[model samples]
Target: MLRWTVSSTDSFLIGYNDLDNEDNWVEADGTQHSYSRWRSSEPNGGVLENAVMMYARDADDWIDVNVESSRQFICKADIGASAIPQPTVNPSCSNGWESNGGSCYYFSSDQKTYSQAQTQCKSMDSDLITIDSEAEWNYTLGYIRYRYYTRDYWVGLTDIGVEGTWVWENGGKEPTGTYHWLAGAPDNSGGSEHCARLDRYNGYQDASCDGAIYYICEDDLYISDAPRSIQTTIQSTTSAVITWTTPLQMDSQNADLIGYKFYYWIRNKQSETTQSVTISSPDTFELVFDSLSPGTTYEFYMTGYNSYGEGVASDPPGNFTTVSAQLRSENYALNIYRIAKGVYLQSHVIFSTEAITLQHCTNICTGVLSCQSVNFHHKATTRAKTCEINEGTRESYSSDVVSDSDYIYAGL
Candidate 1:
């Protein structure tokens, strides 16, 4: 939510202007001021989810506000808003790039080859644009719409010169963050033009730079680097699993998560520290550090990353208890059985000692958290024989479940 304050300045623009500590300021043009008086709710400009709005702070329930509503808002106190510091904005101010408050941007039109269009943008003193955040993207969208281009234009990004090697004309190349591919498109058709274009989708696709496509210009925020998040788990005292989610609003929408790195430390029986563990991946993850010294403690957390940057690591989530394992939380019952190494739970056996069946085995495994694979012992002929439980072979599928009518085993 946007926070507004009546500035000490006596000018009529008083409350509309917002000042940054570095002296950079974003003045709210009468948009909010006029709307606040008549609109039922505060306005919201967030790109993804719509912001919640209420007429008054003391209101019991909040309501959805229009993008144009005006309301005295509260900013998140803990995170606080980041100020965009003033910098040498794109100097070719007169070029196609639009400068709203201070930054500059180039709108695009699909036309010309990649090299040729870049040369054109350079003539304007700006290279192709690199968008990093949703704010920048929102600004670009409006800026592009404001341009008088008849069609989409090529921007600074493309993979035409080298197949599969996408790079910016302004810098060393590689794609960052997750991407949306145009539907059945960007085949680099005919292999003649490798230029790219940015369309309404906020997605990019290769096109003939000279194709007269519309473009976007940019004056960037000097964000040094986004924080990185790292996660680790330890099956220590009580087999604690610690997961830390970062505080940054990264690709929270489409998720640009590269993977999580985990760190864990355990103590030996002598009270000495064990080797720390590190793990990484580009997907949801789970790690268990088993065989911990009972009654010991462990610490761990998770961090996220993409090509653009990594988010801050969450604070350590820790667990203590080396031996006591609690099962059956959330109303789920758990069953742990001692099994023979190499023998799988090929099938399920009834308490009455009936033959094993596939339906029963899968159900049993699904009910238990520790179980990953399941097998039913269907071949056993003895209805009185009790099924055997054993460790499953790691690399191969489960073989036949042991079943023999001759063996009359007793059930517990």
Candidate 2:
């Protein structure tokens, strides 16, 4: 197996063609070295293969290879007198809270339901812990293993809003990278396991939200400022455009502003099926939502995210309603205004019959009292041309209507 050495790049060389010069050798950290362990004819690739690697098969002698090539790499760490320094509790943290990576964590001894645990965290001005990165996850797992080895703890991960789509309490989706779920876990057994818990034996498993379990809470030191100047515009009957400005105090935080997360939900709906979209570019301040239901009002908000996690959502969420459908005309003579090319109404078929032409199909639909829409299909043979009359209109069944090259949908 090839392994990387503490040397790379040929930009420091006095001349590009000087392969035998030891003066050109410099560590990745810019420390000059005169050490010579090169194999015969090594370093001949010069400009192209600038990185040096130790050849394990050839007496561990060094060889030059392309810096971009993937290989096992060795790292060196500096050790001091106090190799592992004792952790000091943060002064700002409350009693019994431990600090790591600029965040304070509290591991509860009392078992509570997921809701109760979140309430307790809210009382302390914190939320259930969200493991944002691999370092945080490792630290949390290690701390739990050492301090609370026999117990399962609840974190702020759940899919209660949208089943099978786990989200952190901070409103970020479960990251695509570095998630730790045991094999065949999160089965959502009995269809009631909407919450996630950290198992002592395994990684993560879905559990009933009502089941009592210990929990962890976190208080971050560097919370990001929320976005401002949120605005929404109704673009059409089924779409809208939302815009917002970047947070005013973004540079005050130590982390970079990576992106923004947009949220929307129907207004006055009991279930409140909220959905979120993550824009991974900090420069993007606007987004268009096209899959909205007509005549429905929706609330919108946005939050900025970074390496730490999601910040607070913008205040005073914008609300907008899509344009409502016009009332059907009482006179069927004006039905030509409802005809749409390359569209087909799905289901609710009142009757299917052969028609001589597209005009004949419309006339047949006009004669049927129950027909609100008609789908006319074109065929090579005149006798094979067909018409399907439906009781539903495109405005009434917007989701069911689809585009098709062979059919024309006309509403009466």
Candidate 3:
């Protein structure tokens, strides 16, 4: 993989040298120097040509050039012990994350404010997508056009901290490639447009932070082998909620996972079903399975799918039994209400930091699964504001440990 060339004014030393007083040459490795192919009058001692060199244009011609003169050189290697094989894993991306060139990207279907989108991406262990290469930029533009149909996406480039000083999400300087900026771009139009997005024209355009738009998240491809550590949390007579840790991919692997394949079957039954759900964002990892017989046990496993292929399936399927039909009832609240000064119902369905209002938390929880109770900890001027949706009535959590007295502890 390497080539060596000596300077024209100086010669490079090889392993061969005249070791004996009689001008008998020998190599550094003690090999007999039996080969000779000198050029016409190459060994002219008056020129002090003690070292040797091969003719640059000929394959076999040799010349006794100056020891310090520069010329082409060749190297040889002997086979050594067998090299140790490196460990390799089937690289893949997590559900909802697309793989591309040593990275996992997630384009959010749910739109959010610029700050909210950045927070959401960070919650999923990623940052706003950065377009560092022409290929990456073109691919992003094409993908956005195909999926969003002329819609815009928030890119990581911004000059908010210092006007006209654009920087990437990872604190890198401006990209060296093409900016693809639209005409009159970063015009500082209104003097408030600091954030940037990939516009429909495949150009980088500055926009206001308040504009709600789908964003992109990028992280290293180091997810696990598959969706593992699955657990069946809550189950009714006909439905069950399953949660699992997200799948992981290796750093050197490329995975373009779009979603997950949920596999389930009734224990000891011949029938089975496989359902696939597209994750709207990288933050989603739970799914609810419905329409099951009462008091029946079911086993389930999951696998992630991407453009490359399907990843390894879960090792052991999670098992859960639904309650009896008589034991199921809809006796929970569907709205957010104040439970106590510093207490909240346990058995939460999901948690979110962007849920700013009680209604927002209620709507998010009620749409997913059976929402019994909900809590909204709204504290302005702080990032700790959150929404917690309670599905089961197990116990209550102390509000002091979660929120302050000014927090809005609502339950439903």
* Candidate 3 residue-wise lDDT, 268-353, digit = tens: 76364544555433345788665677778877777766654455678777778886644223554422344555545544645443
Which one is best on TM-score? 2
**lDDT of model 3 at residue 47?**
20
Estimate the Cα RMSD of every predicted model relative to the unseen true structure. 19.7, 20.8, 21.9
* lDDT value, candidate 2, whole model: 0.72
The reply for model 2, stretches above 4 Å from the true place, is 1-85, 175-179, 224-412
lDDT of 1 by residue, 1-412 (tens): 1114343321111132211111112223223333233133332222221334433323233333222334456432236656656655455355544565334665554455556666665565456675545565556554443333124556666775677677665444645344534565566677755666766444566665556554554433221122233344432233344444332323221144555555455523324553444445554444555445554555444445444344444454443445443334453433332223234334432121122454444333333234444333445564422333223322333354444433322111
Q: Which residue pairs in model 2 clash with each other? A: none
Winning candidate number (lDDT): 2
- Model 1 scores worst on lDDT over the 10 consecutive residues at 16-25
Q: What lDDT is reached at residue 375 by model 1? A: 35
Decoy 1 TM-score against native: 0.30
Error of 2 at 106 (Å): 0.4
